[model samples]
Target: MRRILALLLLAALGALAVWLYPLARPLARYGALPKGLDRPLNLLVLGVSPEYSGYHKRAPERFRGLTDTLLLVRLDPGANRVVVVSIPRDVWVNLPGHGWHKINAANPLGGPELSVRAVEALTGVRVDGYVMVSLEALRRAVDALGGVRLCVERPMHYTDRAAGLRIDLEPGCQRLDGAQAEAYLRFRKDALGDIGRIQRQQAFFQALKEQILSPWGLLRLPQAVAQAEPYVRTDLDRETIGRVLGFALKRPALVSLLLPGRFGNGWAVDQALWEEARRVYFEGQEVAPASSLGRVVAVVYGPGEEERAQEAARRLRAMGFRVLFRPVDQTPGRTEVLENGPGLLARDLAEALGVPYRVSGEAVLGADLTLRLGGDGRGL
Candidate 1:
């Protein structure tokens, strides 16, 4: 009886260690991060398209294809936020040893290492690791999670017999299965073209993040990761991945930004905008308080929040901001500040309001920044 009790106690202690590992690892490596900044883990994610004739065909041993999607994700453990910057595949770049070509071509020309180098050159940001995943991996992961719920902003219909791709979805909020999710992601036939597709990808990512953070999603994560593992190639070790996921489970703030550029011969980089993004989002620089004065601010409040919105506007006016009020049809779950231009105004407003901020593609009321008052802003 004494021996059995001792063994049982040992097993319990081992389980506790396993459960605590993710949280402890990041703390141990805190000193390794750069000085004057939160330790941000930057990951370059490449989504490889199918090269074979069939969509379901097995992937080649070496991932060779023009990347379908490219993203530079920053996981800032200190700030408790995840920032994602989407790079358009069509952006023209001079690949080393290969003449000028689309940024996506970097992957097929050399692989992830070359791709990482090209990205580092383009963004001037150091990438700690890379994750290359096939589209089928996304499908399997979604299916393993049962499915993800997303809102379809408009009716979408596209079909391609050659690639075995089809997308037919109506405008509304609904749950999407594996195949449907893949189709939703791959469809780029609309007027906005690749840019529109990028928007959808961002929305999908936001929804997927929410789903993953849910209690059910956490319980099923192991199965999802297992199903998708075969199609993923990554340099990150399991322990490092665990630390990132563990940080994510704490419900960090999420901010999404698109690589600033305009389409011409190829996507032309907007130098000024890129610089701003590099400083604030990539480098994690804090916005100066003095820059907040005289900025145009728009407050879009949810239904029945007019009083709170007015009070918020009064506070903003007192801060030397010109305020505009707009009423939104639906209520948001949390407060958010949207930046319309390359400035750090949104970051300042978000910081002032104690909420999260994201870069917006469109401007609201021609304001420098827009404040979205949600249920969580009742105190304001």
Candidate 2:
């Protein structure tokens, strides 16, 4: 009886170790939790589209295309907020070793590593990890989910004989199969061009979010993850991935935003606007004493100070201010900050911009706080 009990105890210990390995192994090995996994994280997600000739046939590696989509996903578990910022593929940026080129080219040149470096340089944000998904993987994942239902706003029809691609989508609410869904996402030949396609993509994801948040969808997550694992590549460890997946299952609302830029020959970044968007969406309100009040701010600058105003706006926006630039007719001799009433936001703005401010006068109607740029704008 004693011998049997000892053997059973040993077997139980083995089972316990197996169960605890995933959680405790990293701590034991590194003496710390995985870097940036448990706290706020910025993950770069790329969607790669490889060209194929034969129907439903996986092509060779030589024919793989550029990164079709680039997204910066910021996860703040403490605040339970997830912000996804989409970067347009056509945006022109300087590649580190290479000269000027479209952002999408970074992927094909050196794969995900180069892509990460290029985006980090362009946005001035550190990427904690990255996930790359091929088209085949997306197709399989969508199919595994038993198809997603979405409302098509208009008729979409396109065909490219060279690539053997076809997109025929009628306007209505209906269930889209894998192939049809792919076509819907890949369509871009319209008046709005890539912008229109992005809108549709956003809509599709919203519908997908609803489907995934359902009870039935939750049950199928493991199966979906297993089926799509082979095609998806990522630098994140299994533990971190598991944490992200668990958090996503909670169905916390997602905030989707576009990188603020102008589309010329390629998308040009408006430094001021882009920084503002980043602060309000990416950087949470934790800096100022009363940071929540800086959700939306307006800036009015004097003549001969457009550049200064833009710079000031950029800095303020990056520090969690929703800065809006509005030029005024009257010019000031020096920089001045104004607010409607007693609030911590004005003081925070003044300190951030290194300018003196007052607590009276109508700065900008409907704006929480206002900044006026003067001729001798210091620290702009």
Best by TM-score: 1
lDDT of 2 by residue, 1-380 (tens): 99999999999999766644443433333222333336788999988878565764547644136886888888877767777777878888888888888988988777788899989988878998998887776676677778788766567899887667789987656788778888988899976576567656766776688777777765564455555666667788767866776676455566555565556787776677567556655565433355543577777765566887788778777777777888654454456676543335777778877888754323454466778776563656
TM-score of 2: 0.64
lDDT per residue, candidate 1, 98-212, as tens digits?
A: 9888999999898999999989998888999999988879999999888998766567898776666778987666899999899888888876678778868887887898898
Per-model C-alpha RMSD: 6.5, 14.4
| Model 2 deviation from native, Cα RMSD in Å | 14.4
